[model samples]
Target: MAVGEEQKRSPREQKMLLADSNGQNMTALFSPRFKSAAAMAGWDEEALLLASLVVEDTPDRDSKHKRRFVLHSKTPPTNSSRKRRSQRTPQPVAILDLDEEETPRKDSGRKKKGKKISEGSKVEEGGNELTEKNPGVSSSSSVLPCIDKLREELSCAICLEICYEPSTTPCGHSFCRKCLRSAADKCGKRCPKCRQLISNGRSCTVNTVLWNTIQLLFPQEIEARKAAGILNGRQQAQNLSPESAFYATLMNRSTPPSGEASGRISRRNVATTTSRTQEDEDAALARRLQREIDEQSPGTTTRSRVHNARMRARGGISTSQHEDAALALRLQREEFMQTYRGSQEHVSSRLPSSTLARANLRSMASRAMNLRISDRRR
Candidate 1:
């Protein structure tokens, strides 16, 4: 029966049995107990008989057990074999499976067509494809609100607009440079925001980082502001008198003209010309008053005495360094009038108009003298 079973086994099973027997032979040959027994018995007849019986019995039992286990534990068909069999087999055609496979492609095609139509409509209506086509413009549009907030934060407190040529004060407040300068001129050298004293408002340096940021974010606004400022300056220059216009031009000139004197000399010349013009006007007024007084009282000792007193006052006023020359001359005229009033108490009642006229003329003369002395000092 064993022989029949062994013969009935497949060729692959028979090869597996031979490989198992060879492995068992290798393990037993190398085992310590077999080596020790061989050293002591030296291949005895009894040991050879026992080994033969053990080998024969073990193979029969192991072969039966291994064969049963291998047959029972046979692996299921692999994925590749199952897939090949599925492909070869004729499956039933279902309407639902066909529709499901085609649905995604149909939906995707419809979506693409819809997108094209929408884009075409947008282009036709807006006449601008930048928002859709240009990635950079779209990205920038997303942050537009942030940029606007930044612009508000960077705006000048004085002008209530985005700062052009931004300047920071010692108190860390910022404003447009032109606005800051104008504010300082109008309301003293103090920060418009914080009311902190600015030691040198004229010398406040531009905040380079803030300026660059403003330029970067608000280039169009900055250009517009600059153009407006230039236009305003031109309009002011046109409206100004020739002397005032010349002075404005002189002050605005960043560099001196070729072969011209320095700014200090030009400024001194302007001062001298102004003083001379003022002095000429005062002299003309004094002469006109004197002529009026002479016509009113042709040969009055009061007029002569008043004229002498004025001459003496003029000499003293010219020499004195008092800033309030006008007040001093007025005081002197009052003192002289009091003395005249006391001396001419009887004559003043007979010619009250003449006395009043003389007093008025003396007052005018004193004012003229004051003007001349002030101009000379200037």
Candidate 2:
């Protein structure tokens, strides 16, 4: 169907079902179904920036659109930060009350002696503070990290490092799906703050901003972690932070290396234990895979359809168990030979006709020759 027709369809028609962790099935809404009731179709970044600037400057929605906004700032707006907390009162830019052509003549010496100075000082001190807000969107933190800035800085948003299976929320909040899921456990699948119900799991896209941030800030750290097979949970990452290390070193009178973190914490963060335990799990996985490979019948098994249909159609076909087994063995041997051939090539390139190379080459050539002889005999 065309994209337009697809859009008009019910979200239910496009929903996909998948098994959740509990082994029960559930429906997930997909993105692209969002209906924009207010904003124009083409919300270019330049437009958004301009809107942000307008919000920065004007700070107030016209009274007519008041109810439509989730939170509206009531104070006057400005292009700058207001008075510091230490100051007596906040000052906002006064409304431009002059005509466009007016130019007040400067009279420095005479005015320096007048009550006009006191009047001007009082007027400036009494100006109201400017507050900016998102219309129909509740303010969380007024000075939020900009989305572009986030994309530019972080390598990963959800993990707050490099992204892995990141899922965005409806309100544009994001977490690694697993991380978000973890955070959701502390609250729910919905965002902890917005509470917007994300219907489709797939449509929740990546937060390019957060991902970029991690890449910029910790490129080498990320590479080392990936190389060392390390995956950090939020807690572990938090504990490794500068503030935590600072306090720790100060309290101990010496900096403890991250490797020297408490054993209990390390054990809790990483699932691996002694090397012996890892070997045991490796053995178990090997056995499981072997059993799985064996459980599936060879292509020649009964009820399978590897037999040539065209030969049967031509009424020129006859088959036997010996022929089937020979074919299967030939294929399997070819696969084994191919694997050994790669290893042989690598060994040859790395060594000058080394003993290992000679042995592997001989073994592969012998298998190939035997297979060819067997095929000739057949």
Candidate 3:
């Protein structure tokens, strides 16, 4: 046979070839026990010989490919009119345009027949109009009630409509994101259905199945809801001053663009985002610790310890002896403070807690104590 030409085998020959290959220990190729044993024993002369034998014993491409190629007999063309006549179910009929093809009948008998045909055409046209107006009336009238029932089950309890941004609770109950968020904010972090405690820090995820179902069933409603939501959000945002809007734009822009880095930043600062009040409490605790250290230790040791703690808290950055590490540390702290201040100023009402109420207390208190001592000396 030519090198490029495919080898063809008869049915009998193909059957025998397949049977011979199947009779061999081809099961070992797929066996987990054999794979594990091979890994433990490692490849050797014996193993290599066995592999070569197995490869040789395996069925060729022609044999495997032959099994997949099915031969189907061609079906004869079907007559549309005959098929339509045979079918018992009624179908929407297309009205024919007869103005172009219609010819005048000169004979009186033929003219009478033409009038009858015209009357029948008028009756069919009326029927087509009725079907067009109430399309799928017979088939879909029964289905609509079931769909409305399903929509009721899927609707948000808070809104009493199809759920927007559907989110399911851990209790298997679902609600719209806005509705759930409103409930969480107004009430506690409790499931609306079961009253089970949900963590305030963790937000609910979108219910994909229910969301898709709602979209498929009530596409127009979903589109209208989305447009309304967009308008409302825009109006709310516009109600904010130019300065607040600009600050928000800047904050959104400052977030890391890379998805991985953004994810890491979000994960690392989750505690910070969860509670501005809690972060304030932690900072207060840190300052108290710093003051106690300052009083107990010498100035050099106290500063060094504080530097080390800050570095650790910030995820320590490495610096060579040539680089001014102190300046870099000061710059990072300043940047962090500025970011905090910007965010706090933008959402002061929402924050409901002072993140920097005691920001410089440690340094200011110590300086005042030193100033009093100097005054006593004077």
Best candidate, lDDT-wise? Answer: 1
TM-score of each: 0.27, 0.29, 0.30
The best candidate in terms of TM-score:
3
Query: Model 2 — TM-score against the truth?
Result: 0.29
Work out candidate 1's RMSD over C-alphas.
Answer: 38.1
After superposition, the stretches of candidate 2 with alpha carbons farther than 4 Å from their true spots are 1-165, 181-188, 192-195, 202-204, 208-213, 228-362, 365-369
Ranked by lDDT, the better of candidates 2 and 3 is: 3
lDDT tens digits, residues 1-378, model 1? 998666545544544454446445544655688766766877764566456646654744455456558788466544553243234312122233467789998998778667655643543333234445764552222234465577679999888999888899999999988899999999999998889999898986899868866655555567678768866875688497543443343233212331122433354455645544443444444357545434322224576456445545877753343324435544654554554445346444554322343454456667555555554555
Evaluated at residue 7, the lDDT of candidate 3 is 30
Better model by lDDT: candidate 1 vs candidate 3: 1
Q: Sort by TM-score, best first.
A: 3, 2, 1
lDDT for each candidate structure: 0.57, 0.41, 0.52
* Per-candidate total of colliding backbone pairs: 0, 22, 0
- Model 3: clashing residue pairs? none
Where is the poorest 10-residue window by lDDT in model 3?
88-97
